[model samples]
Target chain A: MEILSSFIKNPRKTTYGGEDNDEKIIFLLRKSVIVNINWVTVAFILLLLPLFVSPPLSKLTYMGMRVINPGFILALNLFWYIFTIGFIFQNFLAWYFDVLMVTNKKVIDIDQSCTDVSETTLSNVQDVSSKVKGTWGVVLDIGDIFIQTSAEQREFEFLDVSNPSKVRDEIADLVAKIKKRNGS
Target chain B: MVPNLPIRQLVIAGKIIVILIMVLYAVFAFILTKRVKLMNANLTTPQSKLFERIARIHMVLSIFVIILATINL
Candidate 1:
């Protein structure tokens, strides 16, 4: 379930504020978890660094005076590890909370700020396009979907979303269905 | 050039600085937990409660570390 959160289709028992009681989320798009590998790797390296770092400092001599106190090392390591944990949590939240979801009624883009939410009705959708860039994106099936709309925001972009073409088609289908229902 | 201060003084100063930084971080962790709660209210997922619990635990962990630093540093 955790792994599936990044790109969930027809999510069950999921809801956002202001949703109608019967409203259903069709696609819940968060940035691909693969994107976090860079920072995760950095955090892993940082966690292991103190072991390699303190030994060299303890052996170092500066003008016949030892450079770093060995006793302070443990506290320093604790500080460093906590800081890294904060870094990991921060990045994870930025990715998790910033969501682009398509529902039966509208498309909502929740920005990284966690407080801002922008949305447009399906009936207002004018165009939908999907693009996959780079080898990794194509291989990993990660891409962006661009939605042209007549609403106030005009465009809603879902970035680093998994399976862009599928989402775009589903959105396009919903828009067409709404247009037919409205006879627009 | 490295200052030739006594090792004990340097350790004490380092501990104080680390504590100050950690205190600021504790404040940030508090803000983060608040924000996480706000987000959960906005978007209630199947995992919302779980994530909210995780955020609170992180906040507590940060405060606990600060206490440990005070005791051990």
Candidate 2:
């Protein structure tokens, strides 16, 4: 009973905090991954080429009908495997790196990279300007958020998150609350 | 029949192109890794560590590709 109580009382430290918070903890206003669907499509097409070419080459080599070395075929397979793996890894990193989080006190852009860099800016809420751009962007439901500030910084642009309208409304609401609290 | 292209010449040309690309990839990876390191120095986070691991893998693959291309050439 004592062990259970301690465990409940002091939860272990975690790398990422939960979405829901009781003490005025605001949900993450926006999340996005940096993948242009077009680029992914291009990479997929390139990776598929080897699959079509490999089988015939392998068969020819096995039958000893072709002068080509078996080792060359193996090398090609290895190269394709490496290329595919690299492509996936690059895409994953791009997605992981691109994120924007909004809380009651501030807006945080956690740009994931080997070098950890986070940019946090306090919001006025009143100056939030949201814009959705491009035909594909509109169709996909992903666009940029422009947060205009009275400060010297000018503006903060949150790029390529799904459902821009919802994120805008949430930010507007938070800003209203903040203004109401500060009597501004 | 048209004169056949020497297999050796074809392989050598392909190898040169592959090596050039691998070298370019390595250069970009190194620059990216340095940028990541600078960011990590400023802020320590689990996400940063994950990025470092990914960069390391990219670097290793770049080296391997270069070596393989050299061998084939």
Candidate 3:
């Protein structure tokens, strides 16, 4: 369950650098794990390719042996497996670390692969909206939430997140609370 | 397609090339470890420690692969 929550849209508790002492983390949003199907499928196919080719690969000779050498072939296979593992790890890190976080005071969007961050204070968050697409989105409750901010950062598009409407409402609520606090 | 030189030399060259590639991969893994650490510092998550450990393990395994290739290739 802990592992499952790592890929989830709203992790129960999370923190970022420069967070205020009183600021509470409301949401830690990640792009849905379902979106990882693209690279996962590629990695799956690559992992299977060597197995299918092992027969033909075994026939090739390097030196005088009928087969290239069992040891050499095993070493080659080891390299192939390591390469594939690295590919999978890179993809997983990109997905796992890329996140958008909402706090009581601000919103932070991080693109970990690129080491990019975009943030806007709650007071400057002008509007928030959610857009769900297609049949799978409807069934899975997965969609994108667009946050229109009045800060230098204008657009925050949280793509393929679970419970888009709820996330939007929560951020909207934070903005509303901020507005109310200022009025008082 | 026969080689102009000897088959043994060709095998040795191939092994050297593979070792070089594994070394480069090891370097890349080290850089990835650094990047993961930096990101973890940027955003401290519940899974941050787990991710940092995985990155360190990956770096170690990458170096191990280079060593194994040097011996077995």
Candidate 4:
């Protein structure tokens, strides 16, 4: 359920931040494109490579040590497996938690990599734009969103998000409503 | 001729190094667990509970593995 769960009854669900009075979530987005996990996938491949080449590698270990205990090697393998599993678990959590939330009043971007968060209020928004570049972005329908605001923070970007145009339009519409309400 | 090292001495030394490394990893895992808890408290969002659950499981499993290694290896 990335951004606006159309399937569920309570469609607008966000992982972080609470809704204010009459403030509702428009969408909750994860980083766009499945390619974001390429590094982790490569790591998995590397982890499994030792298994395939163990026969030759074991010979090398025997030559160096002159007495390689099978039991010791088995224990080491178990340790490595556990360590690798923990590494993968942490990476997945980081990917899953990194979120961009669009609410009626504001947009909240949370970067799980460093746990940094930035927000842009609709009242302060001056311009909204989204870009879908590169072959992968065009083919997969994933892109980045940019918001220019009057506040000190100025620009807020939601990087690598899916359906950037739709997100941009939704934010633009909300900003217009806010402007109209203020008689501006 | 290369002098033959005592295999028992070498094995014990390797195990000690492994234990030291595992201890360091255990500390790192504990710190990560605490960080997740802190983030959950600050955000208190709908998915915070889910995140907390996963964090707890990861921390528990990590510690359990360390204990297993300590006892067996």
lDDT of 2: 0.58
Off by over 4 Å in 1: A2-4, A54-75, A182-184, B1-4
The residue pairs that clash in candidate 3, if any, are none
Ranked candidates (TM-score, high to low): 3, 1, 4, 2
Ranked by lDDT from best down, the candidates are: 1, 3, 4, 2
For model 2 chain A, give the 10-residue run with minimal summed lDDT: A2-11
| Candidate 3's TM-score | 0.86
TM-score of each: 0.85, 0.64, 0.86, 0.78
For residues B9-66, what per-residue lDDT tens digits would candidate 3 score against the true structure? Answer: 6778888887888888888889988888888887877878888888888788778777
User: Residue by residue across A1-184, what tens digits does model 4's lDDT show?
Assistant: 4322211122334435444767676666667537456867866886896597555644544336634355545555665665776677567656655666666678777777536888877788899899998998998888888888898898888777777788788768867987798777
**Can you write out model 1's per-residue Cα lDDT over A15-126, one digit (the tens) per residue?**
8989998788987888878888999899899889988987886786656766555554655676677778778878887888889888888899998766999988888889
| Residue A83, model 3, lDDT | 78
TM per candidate, chain B: 0.87, 0.74, 0.89, 0.73
lDDT per residue as tens, model 3, A1-184: 6444423444655677777899877777788888889999999988988797776767876545743566666667777777788899889878877888887778889895637888888777778999999999999989998999888778988899878887778778867987798772
Clashing pairs in 2: A115-B36, A116-B39, A116-B40
- Assess candidate 1 and give its TM-score to the true structure: 0.85
Evaluation by DockQ, superior candidate among 2 and 3: 3
